[model samples]
Target: MALTTGQHSWWRPLAGTALVLMATAVMTVMLASGTEIAGELANRPLDSEGTATWGDIGDTALALLSIAFAIPAVLLAAHCVQHRPMGTVSSVESRLRWRWLAICLALALPLVLFTVAVQALMPAPAGKSGDLAWAGTPAFLTGLATVWLLVPFQAAAEEYAFRGWLLQAVGAWCRSPWMAITPQALLFATAHGWGTVWGFTDLVVFGVVTGWLTIRTGGLEAAIALHILNNLVSMSIATAFAGAFASDDTAADMDWAAVAIDVPMVLLYATAVLWVTRRRERANGTDVPGGPNTSPPPPTPQTAAASRPTGYMDPAAEA
Candidate 1:
């Protein structure tokens, strides 16, 4: 949902953003920087970018956990700034619709499978095998558990930050959806660091699609669903084919023609998710996307008692 009037104050968003950045920075560095590699790891020079080791997996999980706190930051920010419920920055319903999130996740399954299948078809160079047998090992299972549990929180935290907090704040300031999506998407891509042209393009494409999905779905459900499943698929494939403990960077040049095909596929995937979202809304008789039902629903007693805002009204407005 849109940020309400007076959300443009610049105080809340700025404060929340500062706190999130500082906290995530300090925590992630502490989590990732200190772990000593054991004899079980495939030792490499400290500077070489290669497959992951046991220590790498631990660092990655911890880093993802660091990013996951944005969800709490958002709620606290909303309350402290506007004294409004979370719905003020969420969808028209004024809160996260758990049913919609579940349905979107179901819709995302095929997309995730397709992505993994495509990556599988891409050729992997020699000397890059990540002990495919490790998939059956206890160590791999432990990594799998960590990824399955923490990765979703990592993805959700990003969506809530870019698509939830920053998106609505920008929307409220500029009073236009374009402003909301463009800068936030740019920030998202930039945060991931530089890569090859195709790789950078891929992030941009993903950023735009998820931004548009946030606008279309009026909540983080569709966006979060897409993010969570995509990361899960990426992690699983890396574990199965490449080393699960690999570094996040690449050094040598590789052909990206296969990745090029995925750009259009991302747009198609986003469209499919949105189509499902609108379809669900239509079945419920809302059809808000194409119609003028953008007006938020009236807040009920449940919402009032819930200590979260579900509508685009400032708590002070009601006061």
Candidate 2:
């Protein structure tokens, strides 16, 4: 219904890209205006804030609100740039698949909890704080509350921007899903400013997985669920035990053990999600991810040439 009203087309991606960057810059500057520490920290980057106090958490959360602008940025792009309803970014159905989202959360929660438990057991690096027992304290409660209230929005904003918006934007321009997935993942990792090789690679992998899920499920629900669960627990832990988790992981340390652990975990999670979803799709006669399995019509030479579309023709089409 919405697509019927606008001058939307693949050509709008360029406009959408510009709008997203502008929105991000404007929001960050606005949000950073009142904070004294924003400039200082922007100048002196942290290995990842060692200041694990309530004030620190609140400030960090506030800074994160800048990234949160990406959600609205996407919407503005959808309406103003793409000239389509913003809901198109969510899926072909133009709505969130909440039922699928709930199932994804159920599947993802156990793995996230397991990852946290395993991470807690890893040896702390030198200069890392180990005094994490902040429970039963006013600070802990404040930090916990802040994270619960804000992390969902923060994580959702990120998913919508990278996996939801960028993925669709790039997909509009390219036939292969990898063409869309790769750039979005790269941008996502770079945006984190992880600065370390391990951090960058880890985020890139995370982005790829989420991007793939978006295409497979034809929506952002699964990606948003996983991101919120992963970040909410992880940030809350950091908030509660600010000094407890310490690592010089901000640097370019290509920690193979950490990478090795995560690669398998990602694969395991992907396999589980697909296996379950595939079973459901088959048993219930429903669409999952890539839509139904109806075979595509065989291509004709004329149709194949036409597939490139007019005015958007490849220069090498004659070849």
Candidate 3:
């Protein structure tokens, strides 16, 4: 379901984008500053790169939560500026499809696990330390807890901003999904900051894949599912190993080897989710109809009358 139609005006997307950016900037700064203060108080100041080390649970939460703030920022922009149901930013249906999200998540789990398994078997890069040491029970549990708790929201917030709000904003102005999807994909990659050429390209590929999936499957569920699982798996490994958290690496820092593995995994997920979406649509004999974009079956006369407000009179009846 595309956000191509509605009470859309050419300027709404521009206004909404500005609002989202301003709000996100404000919230991120507030939360990040607070985290920095807490870190200083605990004698665990952030490194030069502003990254938290292993066992620095407070700072880690702050970092993730800063990005998480984008969720409300986008929703607020959609509702207040776009003059549409806040849920519309979620999907064409104006709300999340819980079952569909769950299904996508299940589809993603195996592929992500397989990718992780393969990566585990691959040789480490030449400059990488192969030293193996556990991060102790307390540190590991705390880090894992933080990652699991906040990573989903962090991932979802990104989807809502780039794929949801930005995509819809552009789609409102242009009928072409490519027009809507491509800019956001490029922006999403840029937001990660630059690292290796392979890593940057890989991220762009991810954004494009997910953006297409959001339109094809009629929601952000598929993209969100893949992102959540991928992050959880990667961070869980980092949490388990001593000194892993001390590194300032992000997905943007990935090398060619990592990109080769990641790009294919995302493609596999997109293909599988599309196949399922098509199958479900064929079975129902229509587009998966849950959002405002899909027309619902007409109500029966009696049902319609019963559903009307008490003492309300239809114009036709009155005449």
Candidate whose TM-score is highest: 3
Q: Model 3: per-residue lDDT, tens digit, 1-319? A: 1223235567878888999999999998887677667667777745668753324566567778889999999989877886666776776556788888999999999999999999888888788877879989988998999999999999999999998888877766554667777899999999999988987899999999998888776678898999999989988888988877767778888888888999999999999998998778766664552433344587576554333211112212312
lDDT of 2 at 251: 14
Per-residue alpha-carbon lDDT of candidate 1 for residues 1-319, written as tens digits (9 for 90 to 100): 3345333465666676676676666656654554334322545334344433345566677567878877777666666665566565666566777877887788788867886687667666454553354444665677778889998998988888888877766665554566577888888777777766666667767777787787766678888888898888777555543355655652112236645656666777787877786676666655333224344476676454343322222312322
Ranking by lDDT: 3, 2, 1
Roughly what TM-score does model 3 have, to 2 decimal places?
Answer: 0.86
Which residue pairs collide in model 2, if any? 216-289, 217-289
TM-score of 2: 0.77
Clash pairs, model 3 backbone? 1-218, 93-291, 93-292
Candidate 2: lDDT of 73?
Answer: 91
The digit string of per-residue lDDT tens for model 2 on 185-236 reads 9989887766557767877888888777776656788789888888788777
Cα lDDT for residue 296, candidate 2 = 44
Error of 2 at 250 (Å): 6.8
Model 2 poorest ten-residue lDDT run: 308-317
